[model samples]
Structures are given as C-alpha cells and as structure tokens.
Target: MSNYSRFSRRRFLTTAAASGIGAVFLKGCLGNPPEPVGTAVTEQVEAAEISPEMMPETTKVVLGYIPIVEAAPLIVAKEKGFFAKYGMTDVEISKQANWASARDNVTIGSEGGGIDGGQWQMPMPHLISEGIITNGNKVPMYLLAQLITQGNGIAIAGKNQGKGLGLDISNAAEFVKNYAKTEGRKFKAAHTFPNVNQDFWIRYWFAAGGVDPDKDIDLLAVPPPETVQGMRNGTMDAFSTGDPWPYRIIAEDIGFMAALTAEIWKFHPEEYLAIRADWVDKNPKATKALLKGLMEAQQWIDGVNNTEAVVSIVAGRNYFNVPEDILVPPYKGDYKMGDGKAEIKDKMMGPLYWKDGIGNVSYPYKSHDLWFLTESMRWGFHKDAISDIDTAKQIIDRVNREDLWKEAATEAGFTADIPASTSRGVEKFFDGKTFDPQNPEAYLNSLEIKNV
Candidate 1:
C-alpha cells in the first residue's frame, strides 16, 4: 500500500468543513475565492492544499536533460521514486534537444512547465555569469547541487593511426600551435557548447601542454551525439565530451582515447544542477526540497547494486535512447580501437554521490571556479581581468548558493557546517599544487599557464 492510498479527498473535505472557522482557515490556506456553490467548497479547499508534504504523494518537477548516460541518476530518481521518499511525488525528466535548449528552458521558460533545473556543464556557469548564452540576459544562477565531478574523456581520430600526440611528450604541444595550422589545415574539435566543459577542458589541456588552444584549433560546436560521426568523416581531429560518446567512439574504432579531464585536474568538477539566483532567493523552501530530492536521487544512482538497474532505465526508448550494450559498457578504462592492438586503462565513468565516489559531488569550491576563470581569461573572456580574489569571490557568491545548499543538506541528513564565507576549503590540483583562496595570486602565478 502507498502513502497516498489512505490520503482520501473525502477525509480532507470532512476536516475542511468541520466548522465555519475551519472552512475559513482552509480558504486562507488555499488562497482563493469560493468556487461555484454546487461544487463542494470543502472538496475544492482540500484539493488546493495538495503540497507534496501535505499529501505525501506525487511531487512532479520538470527537469531538462540531454539524452545521454550521464542523466542516469535522474532516470533512477524518477523510476525508483527516490524523489518521493524525499517528499517529492512526481518528477519529470524531459529530454532536451541540446545544451542550449536545456539552459534556456530554465532561464527563459514561462510558467507552462519548463526545466526546473538540470545537469549543466562546467565553465557554463562562468559563461552564464558573463552573459554569453541566449538572450544575453545576465540571469545569474546558483549551483545548489552537483551531479558528477567528472564524466568526460578526450578522443582522437583512430584512422589517423599515428598514435597521435601523447600526454607524456612535449612534442604534442605543437599540434595546434597557431590558428593557421587549422585554416586550410583544419584540425577540428567538437564541443556541445562553444564555451562549455568540453571546450574548457580541451583548451586547458592544450595550454598545460604548452599550446594556445584558441589560436591553434578550429573548434566545431557539434552535439555529443554527433561527435563520433564528426570524427569518422574526418571533420574533427579530436573532441572532449561526456561518456557514451567517448566509449561509443572507441567501440566503433573511429577514435582513440586521448586522456581524461580528471587526469588534468584529478577529481575535477564536471556537471551541476544550477538554478537562477533570483529563483533560489524567491523560493528557498522549494529550492531546498528540490535539492533534497536530487541528493536522494544521486545516492540511489551511485549504490553498487543499482548501477545495472540505472543503465537499464536510462537507456529506455524515451531516455538516452542508446542500446544497452553502449549504455552500460565497462568503465574500468580499457580502450578498444579497431586494430585491437591499442589499450588504455584508468578509472573513468562516475555518477555523482556526495562524498563517496572518487570525484564526489561537493560545493563548487572557489578554487575550481578560479581554475576555470583563469582558463577563460587565458582563452579570453575577461579583458584586463580584475584581481583573482575579487573575481573569484564574485563568481563564487553568484554561482554557488551555499545557504540553499546547506538548507537542503540538513533535510537530506548531511550535518557539515556550510561555510559562511566565500572562502573555499583547501584544494589540490594534479601537479601536486595547492590553492588557498584567501591568497590566490601566488597560486595563479604558480600555474605554468597563467593568462596573458
């Protein structure tokens, strides 16, 4: 039996009509004028009081999702009703056409059921803050929660068959040393959004290897779904995107694994569920409830036994729409190119689970934002950029909603004291270096590839 099974409309009417005073109280709760006299006033009042907590029933939230395996937690959340356990009854996951539509549906959608929020790629939060997306509206948003730390890998066309550039070699740096190299010499790279995680990762990776990505590579904005085809047609040289695309490319022998973004900044931050800053401010309670449900959903998706179950549900005809084989392929780092002679091993694919996974979901630490911001400037977003401290604080204050996150954390049974200031906890990047937000200039100066 379900909780709603005993949630009778008649019982509610009985309570609402117990007295004239009770009727008035119910009316106040309902916030409306009386309906037609023939229609039961008490019944209308009860129907109007149907909040998820009040009914312990359906709580539907519309989410914007791209048809990819990274959306598995959302799929599991919907199918297993993890959301319901958190006082959310109905949760709707809508497959979006692409990252742009997914983003716009939230920032620009009218009341008729747009995305409440969904998985947003990194650097996007910065792009959004910089007013780079559709409408140019500086609709500042908050990352109330994270979905995964990292789920992207770089791939190179296997047909090139030259072992391409190696991560360990300095010679690889010259592949795209100048924009002219890709002119009639087009060395294509694909990203879902021009300023998204794929773009940021590729740019930073090349920069770390001593190459200026913006001036060297001919970047093509292709959907993740088309990345493999783009590579196969020789329209792209390499691309960095979230899974199934990387795995699918390897499985088809069209591309070889270049490197994982996590390798760049191990356990690097990836995707998050961001909300408009005004929305978080106006509806703190609703925002908390939504994050609580998402936290529950993430936990469910990361449970050991639930991996197969998640893959099965997300790959359904209406979800990711990919075959099961491609959906649940082993993530233990075995790269299979066409010749069956090349193999790379590493711990790769992961769904967000707070404090549990290798790259656990955490508050968008300020250092992470700084790293991306520096990269953005290195590639050019801020001209004569402000002090790293001021910019980082501004971005952290605007892009991460700590108050709302702490509220949701309390409801979700997490007890850590949410930091009261913009200061991020200690951060360690891949080169065995640490960044202290309290003093960021020294850290920025230490990086091998600081912005111009």
Candidate 2:
C-alpha cells in the first residue's frame, strides 16, 4: 500500500468531501468552515500557533520539478509530509514542462506567480550566479542541496555492443570515429541538454575513446523521455539520460548499456535543489526546513527496500509516468544491457541522493562546481566560462549554500555524514583523467579535444 493508505477513513472522507468526491457523505457544505479532522486536518494552519522559527517567512512556496526520479527527494518530502513537518504548510510541487521552462519560471519567481525554486540542472546556479543564464537581469540562485547523482545510463547500438569494446567507451568511440572519418557520417547521441551534465557525460564518453564529441559525432539535445524513441527510430546511434529511459532501452532490446554515468565518473553530482537567492535570504528558517525534510526523504529513498514504493510514487501520472516495470530493474540493481551482457547495478552508480548514500554524491562542493565550470567551457556552452580556478571558486562559493546544508544536516543530526572537507578531493573520471580542484587550468589543458 502507498503512504496515502495510512490516512484514516475519516481523514479520507474529509479530503474527499472538499474535493467533491463525496458530497453525499459530507454532512456540511464543502465551503463551510471546518474543524480539525485529523493530523493537519485541512490545508489551513494557525499562524498564531506557528513559532517563527518553525514557519517559513512566507507560507507560500512554489517548487518546480521535472517529474524525473532525480526529483525523488523533493517529491518524497512533499508526499511524506516533510514539508509540512518543517512548517512550510502551503507548498506547491509544480510539474515543469521542460528544463528551459523550469529555469525561466524559477528565474522569474512567485512574484510573477511562478516557481520560487526547484529541481534545476546543477550548472544553473553557477550560471545564474555569474549572470550567464539571466544575462544582466540576473536572479541570483543558490544550490540548497543536490538531488541525485549517477542515476543515468548510457546505451549504445546493439550491433556495436561487443564489437571492439571493453567495459569503457574507448572502443565504441574509436569505432565511431573511424566510421565518421571514412563514411562522413557521424554517430549521433541524444542527451537532455547541452552544457548540462547529461551532455558532459556524452562528451566525456566519446572523448575518453579519442573521438572528439564536438567534431566526430553529433550530440543532439533531445528531451529525456524522448530518448528511447529517438534511438528506436534510428535518429541517434546511442542515447544517455536519467533512469527509466536507459532502462527502457535495456528491457526492449533496442540497445546495450555502455556504462552507467557513475561508472564513467563515480557519483558525478547531477540534479540540484535550487532557489532564487532572494528567497533563501528571506526565508532562512524555511530554507533549513526544506533541507531537513529533503534530507529525511533522501534517507528513506537510500534504502533499496523502498525501491518499488519509490518507483510507484514517481511513476504515477504526476511524475515520470513511465511504467513501474521500466523503473523497477534500475532501482533494484539489475541491468540487462541489450548486448546480452547483464550486470547488477553498481550501487556506487549511486543511484544516490545523500553524499553517504549508496557510496554517494555531493553539494556545493566548490571543486565539483569547478569541474562543471570547466566542462561548460570545454563545450563552449557558456561564452565566458571562467577559466581561472580561484575565480571559479569565488563564483561557486557565492552561489553555493554548503552552510545551509550544514545547518540543516547538523540540526537533523546528520553531522556524522558531513565530510571534513568540502571538496570530494580531485575526482577521477572513467577515462583515467583526474580533476584537481586546485589546478583546474592544468586539468582543462590536459584534455586533448575541446571546442574551446
């Protein structure tokens, strides 16, 4: 049964009464002032009773989401009452139409009756901070928390599954590179966004194999949900994106799993919980409360035992809307790559919400942001992507909310999991490349292929 099953029959009746499902059963008119029916009773809360520390400075918080499982922490918190527990009584987890829309909406904010914050791409906060995404009319955004890391899967053509391939993508890229040069046809790979982490994974995959992602093959920015069909229709030779899509490729035998992104760069921080900086500054307590609830929801999701229920919740109409079967395999650590190579999911692929979860992920890790900034530069995604490591750190620090994460985590008693240092310390990519946060310039110079 779902968490909603635990609600009492009386509570259900009251909710149903308001919703017009049970007008016959309701003793009074739907609009009539009601008494408390149960815990939380109706949506309204008593402002006098709410301690200032416990309440958001403003009760109305509109959080936008993309309906992917990367949104688990946010969705789970709202569904499980973590938001309410933190005294953010009026919360809206609005479904987003696309990444561009989510960014634009959150950038504008509830002042325009738009979203105040949301599950935005990781690079966005930095971009926003630099006034890149917003241009001169910048709306400063902050990374409140990271959502999920390494929940993405890479799928290659079934024909090329084991054709000169080891576990790494080097072999595939080599084949594609040679094919592209001789045939003048570049293999196309679809990702959700350019300059976003998904595109980073795609570029990194090809480049690891000595194929220039910028020149050798076409990288198309297709929506995540459309990737499977894009592959099926031969629009792309391979596709990479968040879970369920790659799982769809695997189950349907259309393509083979190349590597989970985490395999490429273990627990590469992806999606984030971000909000307008003004919102954070205005509602410090509410911000902490948001983190507190999400932290708890993440803990709940970290348990593999909860995978099915987690899938059920996320796969419903309001979320991923993908079938539960498609969602189950990846969540349960099973992978049947279309190439007849089946491997259990790598827990390190995190499939992770917490930095301590399933071998983990990170937040406002200045080094992590440094890497993202470098990747964006590599692709020429940001016209003026910062090349200076020191300046990058300053920019990241300006937008990052590690202090907020610390306050919430410590108050929630998760201090034990906090790392002694903010940096995950020089990350190693699957291509055998190391990124030293101290020397981002050297790291960028080491790359053999880059648009920049």
Taking all chains together, each candidate's TM-score versus the true structure is 0.77, 0.84
lDDT tens readout by residue for model 2, 147-248: 888778678766555664435655466678776675457787887766777778877877877778778777888765576665666656778777877777
lDDT of 2: 0.69
Over 4 Å off in model 2, which ranges? Answer: 1-54, 159-162, 165-167, 180-184, 355-362
In model 2, how large is the Cα lDDT of residue 210?
Answer: 79
lDDT of each residue in 129-161, candidate 1, tens digit only: 556664466667777666766667778886554
Error of 2 at 227 (Å): 3.6
* Cα shift from native, residue 299, model 2 (Å): 0.6
Worst 10 residues of 1 by lDDT: 21-30
Q: What lDDT score goes with residue 29 in model 1?
A: 16
